[model samples]
Target chain A: MSSTTVDDRSTTVTPPKTRGAGRLKDGRQRSPVAMVVMLLLVLLWITPTLGLLVTSFRTRDAAATSGWWEALWAGGWTTTNYSRVIEQADLGTAFLNGILVAVPATIIPIMFAAFAAYAFTFMDFKGKDVLFIVIVAVMVVPIQAAFQPLLDVLGPRGLGISGQYLAVWLLHTGFGMPLCIYILRNYMSSLPFSIVESARIDGCSNFQIFWKLIAPMSMPAIAAFATLQFLWVWNDLLIAKLFLTNDNTTVIVKLQQLLGTQGQGAELLTAGAFISIVLPMIVFFVLQNFLVRGMTSGAVKG
Target chain B: MTYSHSTPPVGGETAVDESDPRVDDASPEATVPSDYGLQPVKLLIGVLGVAATLWVMMNLFLAFAYHPEWFFDSKILMGTLGLVVGVGGAAVLFWFINVAIEALPRKLEHGLVPYAFLIPGFSLMALTLFYPTIQSIHYSFANRDSTEYVGLQNYRELFSEGAFWSAVLNNVLWIAIVPAVTVALGVVVAVLADKLSASSEKWAKSFIFMPMAISFVAASAIWLTTIYAYQPPGAAQTGALNAIVQQFGGTPQSWLSIDTARLNSLLLMVILVWLQTGFAMVLLSSAIKGVPEDTIEAARIDGASEWQIFWQVIIPQILGTIITVFITVVILVLKVFDIVYVLTNGRDNTNVIANMFFNEMFARGQAGRATAIVVILLIAVIPILIFQVKQFREQEATR
Candidate 1:
């Protein structure tokens, strides 16, 4: 009814809105001022990233000799740093390991959270309210506290769960579940009840309703949570360093070692940083549209 | 702009017949079997799960007792058992809860479903999060190696130590500086980006948002290599900042090493501001978009100056979002480790609470002091955490 009402209202206002042309004239007059302000803001915002990019491409010699902006006219660009980075550092292996760790780390939490969120939003059970509150409240517990205990559990002597991918995966899932469920539950709870009821009337079981109806409908939220988790895991250095051993170490941990204890090896650092940054950039670019749509869809009911 | 896709017919019209046999025509009632078989099935699954858990436990005990060498030799057997039992038990419990919810009456079912979904996550959180938090507080009162209970000694030492005081002061400086600068820069960018036309706006926002995807460690490495990186004067500088100084015939300086009182620490703060700017930009950008159009129009109609309108009308409307972003940044600043740890390793007066905690705990093996530092951090963070939770709830309610 609201959708139809909005459509009808917009249709009636169209011809009159064309006749009210003063707004366009006023907007056009302000355009130049707006453009200048925007350019300045863009310049300010991009300065650091531009500096990093320029420095990454420059020769270590050139980079050490001048600011990145000086390279604009100097024409001293070289791919030698990249070559040295690739040759000297095991970036290829690190990149593969990062993907290995990040993909499952992202997917597992999302899968678990979605099921949990659907149950939280749509189902009724005893102690449901208290349980949901407890989960949400867990967001306050700084993750660092869990590091030692989880390490003990994953270590050689305690739980004796050493040198295993599943240890890290399960820990990541446990850590990620709280925020993921909080966000996804909030989103799923706001979905129209009529649709769910109709699905039930159509003899859809709860799992079928979740799989065929809720999952597809909640894609935007899913994508948002997945993107956030992917980035968090991809960028994570501490967890990987602590839980994963030498061979299974993620890109960030490898980069930390490559940078070395005293922070030498700038060439390797730059290349390693770039290698790590590329996937998240691609993910962001691909999912950019869904991001804004997802945020509003979940956070705003209307 | 519109292309090939057909719009669905409107006015609540039924486009398909219900009698079509291709589709399942069973009503909700018909779908439910009269035999009530689900309960028995659920009971069977639960029993199987418990039995399997018991079997694994028995095998583990036998291995530990009789075949100790075999147990010691086989890593895969131990890991596999742990996985099957842990993951399997969880899955079974989840399924049982689902079945129970399905068995409930409609009104009760609706209320219970969401909690069922939340239980697994909550259980995990309770174990990993809440348990350790309580444990940390307990450890704080113990001796250096946690071998003896030295009640209040750690806390007393924490309050008395000069480095601890310096850390407190530095954290205060971080809390004061990082959030204010980040929020201000973010608001300015968000406001300016909002004024642009659609095409240019996305590009500008993307540039601002790009840094956000970078891991703190990677960003720190990049900054260390390019910006704050300094090489000695004679060695042919490899850092970007030093290179620029060399080109200008100025002596190269280690920007991170500068102990110009607190300026080196300030440089570390700059890196945080750079990393967080993107986070602030995205949230503030959305908040700017959410500003009621009529308010801006009214301000303009009143002949308010552009600056006045921005500072007065726009700022007031988005103050809540601003505080939300600010508080989030504050919490992040409190937990900041990668930058300080990587860049300076808490050397040259850059030590904060988190780095101190890590250094004391793992490096020095002073678990009591480390736990004390963590408890301090937890105490400091509690108010901000409360505020954040409250803000999130309020925002949710408004939505």
Candidate 2:
């Protein structure tokens, strides 16, 4: 309901008004002062990342001798940083490990949450509202509270699955499910009741209706959760570093190790930072619309 | 269709007419008679089948995990098998349960299907989150090894320790500064970017949002190397901040180590702010955009200045978003760990609760004290969780 309300408000007000009449200011009186301030702030916002990207491409001597902006014109570029970090620092293995962790971690929770969300949305069960509310409340519980016992359970004395990818995957799934279900249920309940009523009247089983109708209809929310989950798992450091083996960890953990231990590997560190960010960057840009939709759908009401 | 024909209506009012048999009608009153107790038997078989399959699925994965030598030769094989057993196994388990549920009578099937969908997810939460959370609180009452009960000793020791209080102080400082600054900056950027031409607005927002994609570790490394890198007072400073400071004839200080007035902690908070501002901006910007045009126009007609219109008109409308973004960031700040861990390693008196918990548990092997630290975090979070749930309920109620 809020999603549709937001869309209605934006559609009515956004395009025609923003063209010449500033929403905050009077008609067509464009403030050069505002423009200047925005430019300066945008520059400040982008400088650190831009500088790092430049440094990642420059030769070590060139990077040390001059600032990234200066090195831009001076022209000392190389790919050895990327090549060496991948080969010698074993970021290649870490890259593979990141995928290994992120893919399953993202998929498993989405699968489970999709089913739960469907039940919460369509099925008439006792305590359904209370159960949904509890799950929503669990979203704020910090992951730190579970770490010690989870470590014990997954460690050598219990499941003996610590230092394995399974450990991090399970931790991520458990932590990620509440938010996934929350977002998906919010999106699903907003759909019209007629479609589901019609499908049920035709004698479709709950699973048939869910798998064929609801799941397919919920792609935007699913994409949003998938992107968010993939980014979280890939970028995660504490969980991966704790649960994964040293030789087999995600790229972010590898980058942190390179940063901490080898201060001299500035080139490697810069390149590795970019290497770690590349996938999430791609996901963010490609699913940028869904990401924004997902974020606001849960937070902002009409 | 045939099953719907076997309806035995309870109470004559629910009886179906023999003249018009709409077999496809799926109303609740159309209950089928039990074929001499076979329906309950079928339900029993379905329940056992689901339970047994789920049990087998867990043991199968655990069995594979016990022997790494089976696929240890190839990392690819190991990872693929992990996905298969973990993800593929879940898919198979859910499918098996669905089929089993379908075998039951219609009434039993309807009642059980929701549980079939809910059991896997809630069971995961029960195991991973609920059980562990309770265990953590239980361990807080135990000794260092968590093997012996020590009552409130862990709490007493943690309260008495200066390091624990310092971590709490630093956490409070973080909570005080990060969310407020982030929301303020986000609002400014959102409003300003919204004023720009459409294309430039996209580029400007993207630049601000780009940092959100970078991991905290990478962002911290970037900040440490590019923005905060220090050279002793001079000699061609490499860091942007130090370089600018030298340009203004100031000394190049070790920015991260400066604890005088907790400047180092403030510096680490900047990294989180940098990473999260985009999130605040995107959400707030949309909320601002959603503010109706008539309100601003009316304010202007009433001779309100631009600033007045912004505060009195736009701000109140988007207050919901501001609170949402603020609380979201507050939760993140409360759990702040990776940046502090990667940057200072909690050195220079910059420790927070999460990092302190990590050291107490893994680095020092004091499980009781570590869980006590987590209990403190949980206590701090409870009020916020209650407020958030209440807010969500209000929203749903309005819907």
Candidate 3:
């Protein structure tokens, strides 16, 4: 942030010995130039989201003729869009369906991945390294690859489970595994080994150690994956469109459907998008630390 | 091989508090191993007992999943009850096996426990992830409805199609622009914000990070209405850009539908850049903090210019992080669907691979074409996967 002029007074005062804390205020950012540039960029980054927030509250007429900046001073608002989304559009039902989709989709993979992560980290098993590598390698396999095969397997001949929430649930369970397992494995291995050793010497079985010790001890990692999976499931459209029928629409697909001819339901769509995002935003702010950790552990390395 | 612990991950500012990891286990019983077998009578009893438990659990799960009519025909009712029974049933199954293992000779318990821990999770993966992956590759070779083996016909047609090539070109354009621009902007913000006071840094970073929490569908709506929205020449402009243009005595333009120089695709790219810049910034900001402060101080005291220190000392220190963020964002951009699907539905030169794949599969009912697209997408990701694995190994080795 050194903002002081780069010591033109150098000839006047060279101090007896070098002081690490120079008079120059870290000029990279201490200057007003840095503050203005960063703030302008930040404002530019959020303008779209902010525009929607403002426009969502304005009346349809007000939103069309003028910008969000103008609507602030003119003072016009309506709750009709929100009401229409909830009552007439059946967004509430879709939200309920979203819960149905997101809950099991989140818990199933996390629990399953936790078990796999525990065994892979704390216990010795055959083909462990090779198996773990294959699983993690598939982490990069985009969700598109799994959809066609899933359709066949869940078809009448394979399992006859299509159009069922259970089918979608199981699809997410499988699809979510590689990343969740990777995150949990990294976190579990970081846990103190002495805890496992002491518990082992105390005559606790490996199953007991995993369930009683590792599962609870890995709560941060577990929470990280849970937040991520929940957001992903809640926000997902591709998986829902491929797996669920029209009768089983989640909130996201419902919002996409609300996009009438050329987004004619701009008001309703705007409010509807808000309704879909509210839950995940709440989850994100509350567990952002874990989200950051889980994301880095799974995708990025030091 | 020893497990890598606490390698000081980006954003994981606090390392695990472990002075001594598990090399200290010296117990004699832990060292003793036993062959895994029970007597015939015990084995028979255990197998039948576990089999009965699994059979009952399966029936219960099926009943909950299938008999929604009895549960008032509510999907929520069926889902909740099924989850309860499924999870409760699983816990009971695990407890049952643990008790059975305890009944066996004590030395044999260790041999079986690890496999026991692995069974449920691995089975789920086997049924869902592992099986579907193999099946998807198989469908890539079949005909449209997947009823016959076409033998590379789908791939041949896909590669030759104009629409397919357009999708690929758009994908390449998006991947080329979005990640590079996002990382460049993100690094600037991260470096600038780091130089600010702590409170200002937090505020500025949070504003940039706000878009990450919203869904892409929602993000598309925000941009579609607020920025890229269009109207007829006579009507009032709803989109902010066109409105501003009109206010400045220019013509209102349909931003997303405009075709001069592929402006529509670039418009779609802006939405992604907006969403991902936040993610890049957060990770890169944490990484900036991880750069040792004393090194910068040394450079400063040695009369190095701020630009010189940033270029020489800071950027090199965080190159690993820049690559990590870039790759993550690239993967996201390659599968970019919701934005295109929501805003333009891949119309007007905005088609990308994922959107094309979805349209071919669902709208056109071409399963073979769809799976072929999926296989292509999977193939595109393999080099990145190899790079990721190499990075992971390097991490392990360095740790």
Q: Which candidate comes out best when scored by DockQ?
A: 2
User: Which CAPRI tier for candidate 2?
Assistant: acceptable
**Judged by lDDT relative to the true structure, which candidate is superior, 2 or 3?**
2
Question: Which residue pairs overlap in candidate 3's backbone?
Answer: A1-A25, A1-A26, A1-A27, A1-A30, A2-A25, A2-A26, A2-A27, A3-A25
Local distance difference test, per candidate? 0.69, 0.82, 0.77
In candidate 3, stretches whose alpha carbon ends up further than 4 angstroms from where it belongs are A1-29, A300-302, B1-53, B100-112
Tens-digit lDDT track of model 1 for A1-29: 13345445655765654534332221322
Q: What's the TM-score of candidate 1 when only chain A is evaluated?
A: 0.84
Cα RMSD to the true fold for all candidates = 8.7, 5.5, 8.1
Name the fnat for model 2: 0.59
TM-score each candidate: 0.81, 0.90, 0.88
By TM-score, how accurate is candidate 3? 0.88
- Order the candidate numbers by TM-score, best to worst: 2, 3, 1
Give the CA lDDT, 0 to 100, for residue A4 in model 2: 42
> Would you list the rank order by lDDT, best first?
2, 3, 1
What C-alpha lDDT, on a 0 to 100 scale, does residue B75 get in candidate 3? 81
lDDT of 3 at B170: 94
lDDT of 2 by residue, A1-302 (tens): 24445545665666664655443322245667768888898888888888888889988887776767677577789989999889878998899889988988888888889899988888888778789888877888888899889989999878888987778878898988898998899899888767877666565666778878999999999988887888888889889988998866899989988888755788899999989989999989888888887787654210
